[model samples]
Structure formats: structure tokens, C-alpha cells
Target chain A: MKLFFGEIYDDHAILNEEESHHFAKVLRGQEGDVVHVTDGKGKLAKVEINSISKKVVEGSIIELKTDFEKKNYYLHVAIAPTKTMERLEFFLEKATEIGIDEITFLQTFHSERKNIKIERIEKIIQAATKQSLKAYLPKVNDLTKFNDFIKQDFENFTKCIAHCEDDIVKTPLKSILENEPNKILILIGPEGDFSRDEILNAEKENYKGISLGQQRFRTETAALQAVFAIDWELKS
Target chain B: MKLFFGEIYDDHAILNEEESHHFAKVLRGQEGDVVHVTDGKGKLAKVEINSISKKVVEGSIIELKTDFEKKNYYLHVAIAPTKTMERLEFFLEKATEIGIDEITFLQTFHSERKNIKIERIEKIIQAATKQSLKAYLPKVNDLTKFNDFIKQDFENFTKCIAHCEDDIVKTPLKSILENEPNKILILIGPEGDFSRDEILNAEKENYKGISLGQQRFRTETAALQAVFAIDWELKS
Candidate 1:
């Protein structure tokens, strides 16, 4: 099913500008034609086009569904951006395809890349979401400082930090979610890994230190590995 | 520890041309400098630099180790190449980081890509191996016809195929490997997926049909999913 990103309202929906152009100009869509639309917020609809233009495709919602293909669990992956933006972007695209609820770029002690182009990241996520035919879009937040991020409240979430410190005995992520908690938050470290203080601070906040197996992975690879692991845990 | 890709011998080792340039010119190595080298065939060594040049870095193996950090299981993922080359390259890099033994490209009935640049792919695998400090590199084979690929001898391997056909009651990949089969070969379909006739042919060959999950993934994503699943199975 080809899903176009757009906004869904009570009785009608509007395709986003880029999607509108594709529907109107690329696909040569016409009035009265039915198309599948998703608002990337668990809302999907089959709309009949009432008007079509290059940058505006207005349609009346012939059928609307709320909580469309809802996810049973929520996964939030907070990762430190890689030294190279391409790797992080690739991770975002694949994670979206694999299924992610939310993402955050953590500015850690050893994070090399400080600033990221959120607009570009968003476009990549949207493309992957449409390509994978997933209705819900993964939410992305601004880069948050590690200290500030840990200060936030995560009362009900199963918070886990994936670190490579050899001194601590870490449990595998797969084993931690045996009972299948609905809300999961995973923290992935940077290339040099989180500082000793960062790990201790997280532990002080009651964050469980988890492991992503023995072999070491790059910053982006670790994040995606965690994301894929969560999906495997929930799906299986 | 930073790992460099090279060929290890009984008493000495030689870095590949690209790696030699990196070590001699980029890193400015001198005589007596010790470095770690992996032959990508389960051989690793600590070498003391005896000679250094732009394209030739020869060293004496001070400490050689075979089967260094060896994996417990062997995973072979055969997937159809994606239409876009970038997607396939990204998958190769990530799969190497996640740990894979071998890979093959299948020219299926609906294959979008018929040929690939092996030199480029080899370079990617080498870089990922070095970056991940892996002693063994994932062997990549040339594109082969689907029928020819399925006809190959896979007697000792637990062979499985992943497909999205609704009619087939597919077993989850995780479930099939519960017994911890050491050698595993998984087949992933193209963007258009495997043709019905192709699926039937594989089934006739005693290939167990498998599913990655309910969600649909692109050609490259599906292949990486299978790779990750195998790694997860072995490491956990």
C-alpha cells in the first residue's frame, strides 16, 4: 500500500506540500480519486480528492480510522550522534523502517558531532516511514545534554543504558525485557563511550546498565543494534 | 584498540595497499611502532613496524594469534540487491559490524539489480572489519541466479527463506534457530519479493519458509534484519 503523508481532520484531510506535488503532478491524480493518507500520528484515512493542485491536494475523508495499526509497545532510543552525519542518518532511516517510537540525540561527554540537521533527518525518517508503509512516525527531539537528559523524569519507563565498561556486570537487553514492559527507553553511548561519571550518574538515577553483546560496534551501529534488539524483543 | 586490515604470515605481515597508505602516510608510522593487524580470516597479530612507505607497510609479527575473538556461529545471508546501490552498501557495513560470515546476491525473478561493483563492496567490508576490530571479514559472492543459488549444496547449514506472502504459515526466524544451529543460511527476497514459482521451487528443495516480522522492510533492511537476528541468536 502506498501511503502519503498528510494531515487528517474530522471530515477531510490535506496532503503535505511535497506529497501534494507528487499526487498532483507526478502521479497525475485527479478529483474523485481515492488515495491512502496517514498523518503519522496513528491516524489513517481513505480520502476522495475534492480538488487537486501542484502544492495543494484537498480531499474529503471517505473513511477514517483512529489508532491505525497501533503499536503495542513504545520504544525510545536516545543515542549520541556519530562523528560522521551519514552514519547517524543511515541509522535513523533503518530504525524507522524497523519500527521506532521516538529518538533523541544525546550530547554526551565524548560525542563528536554536536549539531545535526534536524530538517534533513526528518525528511529521511518520512521517506523511510512511507517506504515501509508505517503509519506512525518516530518522534525526534533536539540534542539534549546528557546531564540534563538524565535529570528528566522517567518514572514509568524501563530505562536502560548500553555501555561498554568492562568493570560493570551488565545484563543483556533481551533478558531485561522478559516480562515485556510496554514503555522502554534505551541509551547508547558515543564513540569513546560515556564518561565514568555519566555511567555512575545514570546508575544513581536507577538506570539499569545493559549490554549489546560482546563485540564492539560504532556509535551509530550500537544505537541501531539497540533499536533492532527492542523490535526483536517485542515482536518475538 | 584500532585494528588495521592486512595479510598475516608466519613471521611477518603486510598491510593492504589502502591500509598501508593509511598507516604510513596518514598515521605517520615509523620503525618499531607496534600496530594491530587482522587478516580477516580469523588471524590477528601485534606487529612491530620494520619498514614503512606510502603504499608498503611491512612489519614483523611480534605476537600472532589465530582464531582471535572467534564467533560461535556462522551466518550466511543471501539477499537480492537493491535498486539503489547506496542502500546495499549501508547494509554491508552494518552487517559487518553486527558480525556476519558470508553474503550472496540473488538475481531473482523480480531482481532490480543484476550486477554489482565487487571492488566497491569489498572495500566497504574491509573498512567495516577494521573499524569494528573484527578478525574475520564477511565473504561476498557475485550475483547468481535464484535457481542456481537454491541448487547449491547447503546440506550442513540450516537453510531458511524469508518471505511476506500471506498464504504461507511462516516460522519466525528466532524460533527456527532455538536449537542453536552453528551454520545457518538465510535467504531474503527483493523489493518485489520472491515470485510464487521461486518460493515453490525453494520449498521443493526443503527450504523452510520464515518470516522477519509483521512489518514490511525494504530489500536491504530485510537482509540486515536477518543478519541482526542471527547475531542476536548467537550472542545471547
Candidate 2:
């Protein structure tokens, strides 16, 4: 069954513009057709299409399913965006498919790209979620300054920073994930990597230095590896 | 220090056309310059540029270092080529970066692509190997049929196949990697997945069914995940 995204209002659900186009034009969905829809908030509903339009598609809920897939842990990865948007988009798509809770673009001292279009990233996230048949939609937060992000209190979250600085004896991410903390916050730097002061500041803020692997990975690859490592550790 | 690929012949080394172009034109390497060269066969040498040309560059070995990173275990992933070449190229590049010993393109029942250009893929592997500064260059074999591949004798090797068959209760890859076999061979099916008979035939041939993760991953994603999983298991 193909999955669509929409919002549930009362007994009806309305798909947005893109979803509407996909349903009405691409899929050739007609009135009275049955479709599966998700609200991106862990709600899945079987609905009968009542109206099909270019802008919006309305449907009446036939059955509602609240028991969608739920993640066992919370994974928040804050990464410095790559110079090219494709790499970051690829990371976002793969991370969504592999199960990530949240993603934040960080503006660090060595970051090449400081600004990111959240709207574009959100679209990729939604598409990946639907493609993977996932109920929970991961949030894409706007770009935040590294200093400001570190200042925010994570409280009980297990914080770690991924850098390539040789001066610091970084713990392997696999070892860190061995403990399997319920909430994980990992910071991945850009191509140039985080500066010494940035690493020190993060360490001061309780972010432990962690290394992804022996080979130096690109920004996007490191981010994806972090997500995969976390997910692997949690499940295993 | 910049890294170049060349064959150390006696007391001298010769760079290939692509490497020569990169050395002479891209980097503007001049004579009498010192550069790090790798033979891609677990050998790294410090060489002095004796001659520079667009077609081929010659260097004399000044010092030799053989202490290259070696994997304790062997990983050979045989996967069906994706419909698009880019995804397969991406997988090759990433697998090289993440440390893979061998890659084979398989022609399965549901495989969208049957033929792959070995030369193009080889270039990607060499570039990724240089980018990661690794001494080991992975081997890319020509495309082979799934049936033929399964029939081959993988003596003393832990052979596994990744298929999305509904009837079979696939073992998680993590569990299979727990034993830490010295040699591993994993086969990843294409987009439409392997035919039921293919899975059964493999099972009959001692190929264990392994699941990468819970989510449905694309061909390239599954390949990369398998490589990453194997590397992680061996390293940890």
C-alpha cells in the first residue's frame, strides 16, 4: 500500500499540495478510492477520498491506527553543513530512512555553509519517511550557532562531539554507544573540522570527544555513520 | 603531504595517466619534489619526482614504508548493481573509504542492471582510496550471475545473503557478525529483491539469510550498511 502524508482534522484528513499532486495526478487517485495517510505525528489512517483537487485532497477517515512504529531512543545529530547541498540532502534522506529523531545544522568556526533552507530539508525528510513507511517524522531544526547550541542545556542527554583533532585522545563512537544511552546528542564538524577552541568549549560543556572510525570521513558520511552506529548499538 | 598512486618498479616508480595528470597539471607538481606514493598493494613509499609529464610521471624511491593499515578480517560484498550507475558508484566510493576488501556485481532475477563498467568503478575506488589515504586498494570484479556466484566454493567462509523474502526468518547481520569470522561474504539483492527460488537456492547452498536492519533500504544503502556493519563488528 502506498503511503501519503496529511493532517487529521476531526474525521477527515487533507493532504497538502505536494501530496495532493502525488495522489490526484501522479497516482491518478480518484474519489472514493482508499488510501493510507499519516499525520507525521505517529497517526496512520485508512481513508476514502472524498474530493480530489490540484491543491488539496480531502478524505474521510475509515480507520485510524495509533500504533505506528515508535523509536526506542532519541537521537539528535547536530552537524556542520557541507559545502554542497546534495551531500547534506543525501545525509538527511539516509538518516531519515535509518531512523533519526532530529537534525540540526550547526554554524561552527570552520563551517563552509552557515545557512540552510529548512523547507527543502523538511520535504526530503517527509518523502523519505513516506518511502520507508515510517510513522514518526524527524524534525529538521533551523541552523544554529555552535556557541548558542552548546549553551543550551541538554540536561540528561548523553552529549558527544566528533572531531579529528589528534591532540585529544578521542573515544571511539562504538565504545561510547556500547553503554546505549537513551538520549544521544552527537556533534559532527565540517570538512575543516572543529577548531581547537571549539573542541575545548564543547568539552567544557560536557560534550565528550568521540571518533567515528579510523579513516577520516566526509562531513555527510560521518553524520550518517554516527546515526547508523547509534541505531546499531541501540538495537543490538 | 600529497598522495599519488604508482607502481614501484625496482628503485623507481611510474604513475598512470590519470595520476600523472593530477600530479603534473592539477597539483602542478615539479621535478625534484618529494611526494608520497602508494602501490595500492600495502606499500607506501617516499619518492622524488624525476620527470613530470601529462601522460606519465616517473619518480625514484627515496624511502619505503610498509607499515600500512591491515584488516584483521576479510569482507567481500556481492551486490546487484542499482538501476542508476551513480548509486553503485557512490556505494563503491563509500565502501572503499569505510574499508572494504572486495566488491562483486551480481546479476540476480530482479536486477535492473546486468552490466557494469569495471574501469569507471575502478577509478572511483582508486580516488576514494587516495582520498582516505589508505594503502589497500579494493578489488572490483566483473559482473557475474547470481546462480553462478552462489555455486562457487566459498570454502571456510561465512557466506550470507540479504533478501527481503517474507517467508524466511532472516537473522540480523549483527548476530551473524558476532562470531567474528575471519572471512565473510554477503550478497545484497537488487531493488525488487531476489526471487523466492533464488533465496531458497542460496539457503540450500549454505548461504545464510541476514537482515541488515528493520527499515527498507535501497540497494546502495543496504550495501554500505553491510560494509559498515562488518567493519564495525571486526574492529570492535
Residue pairs whose backbone atoms clash in candidate 2: none
Per-residue C-alpha lDDT of model 2 across residues B1-236, encoded as one tens digit per residue:
78888897778888877889999998889999998899898888889999986699999999887848888888899999999898788788888888899888899999878788999899899888988888889988899999999999989899999988878979999889889898999999999999999999999999999888887799889988988887877864
Estimate candidate 2's alpha-carbon lDDT, on a 0 to 1 scale: 0.88
Model 1 misplacement above 4 A = A53-55, B16-22, B53-56
Q: DockQ of candidates 1 onward, in order?
A: 0.78, 0.67
Q: Which candidate leads in lDDT? A: 2
What does candidate 1's lDDT look like per residue over B59-103, in tens digits?
Answer: 999998899888888889998989999989999999998888999
Give TM-score values for chain A, per-prediction.
0.93, 0.92
Q: Given the true complex, what DockQ would model 1 score?
A: 0.78
For model 2, the docking class works out as medium
Positional deviation of residue A54's Cα in model 2 after best superposition, in angstroms: 4.5
TM-score (2 decimals) of chain A in model 1:
0.93
